[model samples]
Target: MDRRAFLTAKKSKQPASVKPLPLEGRTSTGLAVYTGAWTKSEITHLLKRTMFGARIDDINYFAAKTMGEAVDELLNPVAALPNPPLKDYDGVTGAATPDNDVANGATWINSVNNDGTIQSRRRASFKKWWMGCLLQQDRSIREKMTLFWHNHFATETVDVSNANLLYKHANLLRTKALGNFKQLVRDITLDPAMLVYLNGRSNTATAPDENYARELQELFTLGKENNPNYTEADVKAAAKILTGWRVDTTVNTFPSYFTSSRHDATTKTFSSFYNNTTVTGRTGTTAGDLELDDLLNMIFAKNVEVSRFMAKKLYRFFVHYDIDAAADANVIEPLALILRTNNWDIKPALTTLFKSEHFFDVLNRGAMIKSPIDHAVALCREWEVVFPTAAAEYADTYGMWNYIMSVAANNQQSIGDPPNVAGWPAYYQVPQYYELWVNTDTLPKRNQFSDLMIGNGYTRNGKKIVIDAVAFTKKLSNPGDPNELINELFEILFQIPLSQQVKDQLKKDFLLTGQDSDYYWTNAWNIYIASPVTANYNVVNTRLRGLFKYCMNLAEYQLA
Candidate 1:
């Protein structure tokens, strides 16, 4: 359509927030497949929950496929594991431990460096690389799931001070992100960083440290709130079964090892919650693996509790925070059943939940408050903010990543280090689950981040990364018409739709220069499109920048 006819044609009213259908009403359809209209709203909801942020390209791409196909592709990742973090910190400080073995640009994950200062720098580099992964993530759910598992098995880089060990622990989480949950627990039990953080190395026959054992059931699997859960005696017995495992710090490869001398060769018995199961004592070389298998068998036997606990966590992360009795009975229970029926495989359960009618319900949409990382990364992607390419400008790219990581850390969701073993309280804490992410201090900082990006942005190594307002607006379907432009921007930037009155005020105040007629914006956009000169570009660009800035500051932008 030509610009004049497009503006003169009879246009449909702007879509309001999703409302209940006349027939189905607000009642949830539960885990059944969603057969509703697949528009931009539905696509945005799916990607917002599954990935970090929903890009326009991704939205258009997924719109052509069935919801089942999109969810399947997200669950099944084919991308290779990202290369390890490099040695990108040399000139920052002279007093830090000199990494003599690795070159300046080489990856430090393989070389074992025990120096405290150098290890600290490497940890920072790891954080930068992690931020890059989120920014450059594929269409799959690997990076998000990797972060979920990291929080599930929380560890602090400060506590586990070895950089190499931290890399290995994270690699383990990424590798088994969508794999078997039961086996992930098994692998994390023997991870060297975990052994250091939870005092697993100190757990021996003479002095049994119950730190890891208690957390294994209480936090990781069965959960502390379950009725008739494992007892204190169960914790002690589990610790005894796990006594012989120790970290071999000298070797860089496979640092965790089992020591026969440290093994407590006594029969360990559990409480009636475990059906009074007993792991028999063993001797010789394979005692540690044998007892561990027995322990996992005992814990996973109560598949109902294990599955329910994990199902709740996943629900909170990927769906809404408040899981009332209705959600529990209808959504969580069936999802847990799917998880257990699949023998603890994570893919099938997530696939069913993402494609469910309950998940795509109107009430479920825009219910979640974006976490710190979500707020930061989504702004970059949805605005098409640019960052230096890592392959071409390694230091400049990592420096930009470090700046991004620092912003998120200041807002209180550090990537490599969560606050505690229970992970971020926002995921599991009751009464105010995700609301913990936004307080007086963090909210201002959040707005400041958006303000900075849409305005000046951050600069590093002679490269300035900022959101180009004109570039973003040009990508819209109809930028010449002020109403259509607002509609397209609202469709991408917001989870919920703005009222028509508010959108009109926004257009008049910013786009139309406080005038009543639409031709003001239409003529200005046309002039810029025709001439392609600096003064003409400034006219449209200035208005677009103001419009975006005002929209981002709204409370609605913070919701997913």
Candidate 2:
């Protein structure tokens, strides 16, 4: 009984009774309050929550919108930018050109030859393009989703240094970012980077590596602890079934093919839990490829396991982590049903989750803390601050853009690479993710970055870019009514209502600034805009420094 026969039989079998909930009702935990309008504070909170931080343009854009409109836009963003064409890695014409000899001097001089130089150039180009996407791309959701999948797939550069291999993997993720989950999984299993990362490069009949096979079941498909659907026997059997896949480095491209000679031509068997199948005599010239496909079919054939596992992970990533058995039966089960019904179409499943009433529940709001990448990207977007241009002229220049990447790297939040195959540990724990993202060290760094942004120490090139406090204040139509202004600001900053005490405190702080209402509001805006004042700058530098110190010290800075 091979994997295919096993899976086909499993699908036909009926599952146990499990009562599912309505797609719109609250979880077992109960419902959250429905705040009427989104304010500046709310926009700020939203920016902090959904993205890295607020950019000036993003803040203004949300500030002008109503609550329903803002939520709608976030759920179904129209501004997503298309992925740019990837440069070839073969050093053929139109491939990403090598940096100057001077740039490659140290690494190349120490290495054996041109191979090292080419690899170095490819690495540099890859990093630049990835970072560029963060700074300049208009599509926020695609980038966000890319990051999500990157963690989920968890491939590393150590296995495949060929730029083409990495780029191909990345392109696949971009293309299928919001597509079908089944296809995405199938596509990833064949990716060259993934093949190399998981030791599938040498998976063959003589010696099979269980690395990829085990992880596919335990990590990617069905999680370990919550759902122990597959056993050790299943893993060993799957490994034998998966042998024979290999990379064609001659092309220096991705989507590696199968080498028939290397495939294991033996039958495999699983435990009684897996329907007690004796998968045998299935091997042929196309054994490896067919066996792998058969294995996936068998896995998906167990609809209950995939459904429960995916729902839990998706809930942790997109909603709350805490799971009640009743809620799982209701929300998770129903969403899983959609996936099963639609052959695992990811977009529809996600769309269903977003539109579901439970998504907007107050309890789900502010449940997740901003990951480091989210925090950084949101700041750039909300402030509308222009990052470094990627032209040939200033390729060596270093400042905030460099600093931003450095900070991210330091915080163990590199965009392209995660800590391991498992992904960021904090995201797995649920509500504790809020506490997990920050600690004594990271909290201060977060504040320091905020202060740098609000103070005059920060700059683009050599020129001082003013945040235009007056312009921000003038955007408000009702300067006379402090409460209205605060409410309006909150609408721009966060998508949730501010408590009366928080509003009053902000109002009192604005009044103490000694400027007129409009002036004071504008000044505060300026402080947030022109942060990180360096010594020996301009006149506004001192004021910006003082204001930044005060603002970063505030507890509100940590919330978003």
Q: After TM-score superposition, what is the CA distance of residue 484 in candidate 2 from its true location, in Å?
A: 4.6
TM-score of each model, in listed order: 0.94, 0.77
Off by over 4 Å in 1: 1-27, 91-97, 390-392
Error of 2 at 218 (Å): 0.4
Q: State the local distance difference test value for candidate 2.
A: 0.60
Kindly list the per-residue Cα lDDT of model 1 for residues 1-560, writing each as its tens digit.
Answer: 01222122222222233222223222334676777878888898989888888888898899999888989998998989888888888724653556777887888887766677788888889889998889888898998999899999999999998878888999999889999999999999999999999999999999999999999999999998788889999999999999988887566684899998998989999999999998999988899999999999999999999999999999889888777666776678889999999999999899888987778876677778888888888888888888977565888888988888888899989988899999999998888888899889999999899889888889986798899999988887889999999998898888776889999999999999899999999999999999989999999988999999999999888888
User: Highest lDDT: which candidate?
Assistant: 1
Residue-by-residue lDDT tens digits, candidate 2, 348-423:
6766665444555444555455666665655555545444444332433224445566566666577667778888
Q: For model 2, how big is the CA root-mean-square deviation? A: 9.6
Q: Candidate 1: global Cα-lDDT? A: 0.86
lDDT of each candidate versus the true structure: 0.86, 0.60
Q: What is the lDDT of residue 246 in candidate 2?
A: 81
